[model samples]
Target: MTGVVSRAKGAPVELVEIVVPDPGPGEVVVDVAACGVCHTDLHYREGGINDEFPFLLGHEAAGTVAAVGEGVSTHAVGDRVVLNWRAVCGRCRACRRGEPQYCFATHNASRPMTLADGTPLSPALGIGAFAAKTLVAAGQATIIDTDALGGWWDPAVAGLLGCGVMAGLGAAVNTAPVRRGDTVAVIGCGGVGCAAIAGAVLAGARRVVAVDVDAGKLAWAQRLGASHTVDSSRLDEDGVVAAVQALTDGVGADVVIDAVGRPETWRQAFYARDLAGTVVLVGVPTPEMQLSVPLLDVFGRGGALKSSWYGDCLPERDFPALLELHTRGRLPLDAFVTERIALEEVEAAFATMARGDVLRSVVVLDGSGAGATS
Candidate 1:
C-alpha cells in the first residue's frame, strides 16, 4: 500500500510504499475513501507531538470496512465508517461511570504498520488513513449511514466529522451546551472556530460573535452563521472582551469558546463571558505554555472553565447525528471542505493550511476528486 510517511524531524513528508498487516483480533482493515489534512499531522512531522519518527501521517478519515479480524463482530466488510482516534475501552473507570468520552483506556491496533524495510511506523493518532488502506481497532471505526438522504452524501465531506470539525462542534454543542436565545462568542476563526460558531447557531444561540486575527477567517465565520465578528488583529485582550460584551448587551456572552489556545485569547474568552457564563477551551496548546489568572476572579466570576477533549464527543452518537443534520441542510458541513487533493498532495496542502488559505484540504484517496457532493 502507499501512504504518506514523515521520516525525520521537520523533513517533508513523502509518499512511499508501506506494509499494512491484516487485522488482529478485535481490529479491522479499512479501504480508506477520504482523509482530511489536519494540523495534528503537521505537529507529528515537526516532532512536536513526540519523537516518534517515520509516522504514518493522517487520521481524519472515512472509509469502508475491507476486512475484520477475529472476535470483531461489531463491524463487517462493506460498512461505511468514519475513523476516530479515541476507541474507548468499556472497562475504563470513565466508561463505567457512563463517561466513555473520557475513557482512560482507548484502544488501537496492537500491531504496527511498517515501511517496506519492515521498520515499524507509528500511525498518526493511531489510525492512519492517508493510505489506500489502514488498520485500526474495530471500535475506532464508527459506521455512518451512506444511505442517508437517499445516498447522495459524500464520504469526503463526512470524513471531516472524524476529528477537528467534530471537536469544534462538540465543544459548543456538548461542552458549553449553548442554549436557545443565549449569546455565544468563539475566539479564533479557523476550521475549529468556524465549526464552533456553527454549533452555537444550530443550538439556537441568539447571537454568535466570531473573533479572529484574519479577515478572511472572520468572513468564513460569518458564513458559518455568526451574527457578529471581531477582528482581533488590531484589538487588545481587553478590547476583545469589550467588543464581545457590547454585542451581548454589555453583559458578555452566555458562552465563550477559546479555539486559539493562546494565553491572550484565553484571557479574552474568560472576560468575554457573563458572570455565570461558561468558558470552553477547545484549542491545543504547547507544553511550554502556562496560564495565569487572578485567583479572586476565579471565585468572583462564578462560572465554569472547561477544556474539551475531542469536544468530549462520543463518535457513535455524534457522527451520525451531525451527518444527518448536514444531509437535512441544517448544518453547513460542506463549507468546511475547502478543496480536495490527491493523497500525494498532502505536503502542499500543509503549506496551504499554514498560510490560512483553506479550512480543510482533504485527500481523496479513492479518487473521487475534491469538493462536496450533495
Candidate 2:
C-alpha cells in the first residue's frame, strides 16, 4: 500500500510504498476513507515528539472495517468508524476507576507497518491512517452510524472527530464543563480553538470570546459562534486580559481556555478568568517551555487550573454523539474541512497549514482527488 512517511528529522515527508500486515489478535485492519493533516504529524516529521524515524504520519481518520482479527467481536467488516489514538485498556488503573479517558495502558497494534524494504515504521499516535489501509487495535476503531447520519455525510468531516476537533470540543464541554449563561474565553482560533468556541456555544455560554493573533482565525472563530474576538497580536497579555474582562462586566470569564500553549497565552488565560473560575489548558507546550507564576496568587485566586488531555474524551461515548449533533445541523463540523487533497499532497498541506489559511486540510484516501464538498 502507499502511505506518507517521515524518514528523517526535520525532513520533508515522502509518499512511499508500505507493507501493512493483516490484523493480529485483538486488532483490526481498516480501509481508510479520509485522514486529516494535523500539527502532530508535522511534529513527528520534525522529531518534536521523539526520535522515532520513518514514522507513518497522520492519525485523524475515518474509514470502514476491512477485516478483524481474533477476539474482535465488537466490530466486523463494513462498519464505518473513526480512528482514535487512545485505545483504553480495561485493566488499567484509570479504567478500573471508571475514567477510561485517562487509561494509562492504551493499546495499539503489536505488529509494525513496515516499508517495502522491511524497515519498521512508527505510526504517529499509534494509529497511522495516512495510507489506503492501516492496522490498529480494535478498540481504536469507534464505529459511527453513517447511514443514520445520511449516506452523504462526508467522511472527511467525520474523520476530524478523531483528534484535534475532539480535543478542543472535549476541552470546553467536558474539562471546563461550560454551563448555561456562563462567559467563556478561548485563546487561539485554530482548528482546536474554533472547536472550543463551538463547544462553548453548545454548552449555552451567553458570551464566547475568541482570542488569536491571526485576524483570519478570529473570523473563523466568529463563524463558529464566538460572541466577541480579541486580536492578541495587537495587545499585550494584560491588554488581552482586560479585553476579555471588558466583555464580561470587568469580572473576566467564567471559563478561560488556552488553546495556544505558550507561557504568555497561558498567563492570559489564568488572569482572564474571574475568581474561582476555571482555566483549562488544551494546547500542547514544548518540553523546553517553563511556566512561572506567583505562589501568593495561586492561593489568593481560588480556582481550578486544569490541563486537558484529548479533552478527557472517551471516543465510544463522544464520537457518535458529536456526529449526531453535526448531522442535525447543530454542530458545524463541515467548516473545519478547508480543503481535501490526495494522500501525496500532504507535504504541501503542511505549508498551507503553516500559512494559517485553512482550518483543516484533509487527505481523501479513496482516490477521489477532490475536496470533501465536491
Candidate 3:
C-alpha cells in the first residue's frame, strides 16, 4: 500500500510504499476510493494536534471493502462505505449512557501501519485514507447507500459526509437545531462554515448571515442560502458582533456558529447571539490558546454555549439520512466539491487548502486516473 506519511511536524507528507496487515478481529481493510484534503489533516501536518509523529494524514474518505476480519458479520468484501472517526466503544461510559458519540474509548485498528523501514505511523484520527488502502476498525466503515443518495450530495460527494461536512452540517441541524424562523449566523466561510449555512437553510432559518475574511467564500455562502454576508476581515472583533446583531434587529442572531476556531471569532460568536440564544463552537482551536470571558456573561447568557463533537452525529442514523436527503435534492452536497485530484498530488492539495483556493479538493480514487496507480 502507498500511504501519505507525515514524518514530523510542519513536514511534507511523503508518498511511501508500506505494508497493510490483514484485518485483525473486528477490523476491516478498505481499498480507499477517494479522500478529501481537510484543514484537520493540515493541522496534523503542522503538529497542531499532538506530538504523535509520523501521522497518517488523510481521513475524509469513501471506499470499498477489500477484506473483513473474523467476527465482522455486518460487512464483507465489496461493501461500499465512508470512513468515520467516531467509532464507538460500546463499553464506554458515554455509550453506557446512550451518548455513543461521546465515546471515551473509540477504537481503531489494533495493528499499526509502518513505514518502509518498519517505523510505526499514527493514522490521522484513526483513519489514513490518502493511499491505495488503509485499515480501520469495522465500525468506522459505515455503509452509505450510493444508489439512494445523489444530487448535491452525489455518491462522489460522500467523502464530505465522513468528517468536515458532517461536523459543519451537523452543528446546525443536530446540535444547534436551527428552527424555522430562527435567525442564524455562521462565522467562517470554509467548507464546514458553508455546510453550516446550507444546514441552516435546510433547517429553515428565516435569515442566514454568512461571515468570513474572504469575499469569495462569502459569495459562495450566499449561493448556499445565506440571506446576508459580512466581511469579518473588514470588521473588528466587536464590529463583527455588531454586524451580525444588526442583521437581526439588534437582538442578535438566534444561533451563532464560530467555524473559524480562533479566539477572536469565538468571542464574536459569544456576543453575536440574542440574549437567550445559542453559541455553537464548531471550530478546532489550538490548545495553547485559552478562552477567558467575563464570568458575568456566562451567567447572564441564558441559552446554551455548546461545543459539538462531530456535530453530535450518530453515523448510522445521520449519514444514511443525510445521504437520502441529498438524493432527494434537498441538500446541495455536490457544490461542496470544488476540485478533484490524485493521491500523489495530496501535498499540492494541502498547499491549495492553506490558500483556500477551493471549497474542497477531493482525491478521487475510484478509477478516476488515480485508481490506475492504486
TM-score, prediction 1: 0.98
Runs with alpha carbons beyond 4 Å of true place in candidate 3: 150-155, 368-374
How much is the lDDT of residue 258 in candidate 2?
Answer: 96
Between candidates 2 and 3, name the one with more favorable TM-score: 2
In order of appearance, the predictions have TM-scores of 0.98, 0.98, 0.95
Ranking of all candidate structures by their TM-score, best first: 1, 2, 3
Model 2 segments more than 4 A misplaced: 367-374
Tens-place lDDT digits, model 1, residues 164-283? 999999999999989999999999999999999999999999999999999999999999999999988889889999999999999999999999899988999999999999999999
| C-alpha lDDT (0 to 100) for residue 238 of candidate 1 | 93
Q: What C-alpha lDDT values do all the predictions have?
A: 0.92, 0.92, 0.87
* Residue 246 of model 2, lDDT score: 98
Task: Report the lDDT tens digits of candidate 2 across residue range 1-374.
Answer: 88999999989999999999999999999999999999999999999999989999999998889999999999999998899999999998999999999999998999899999999999999988999999999999999876766654467998998999999999999999999999999999999999999999999999999999899999999999999998889899899999999998899999999998999999999999999999999999999999999999889989999999999999999998898898788999988999889888999999999999899999998853343332
Clashing pairs in 2: none
Predicted candidate 3 versus true structure: per-residue lDDT over 6-118, tens digit per residue: 98888888988877888999999998878888988988899888879988778988888999999999898987788999788889889999988788998889998888788
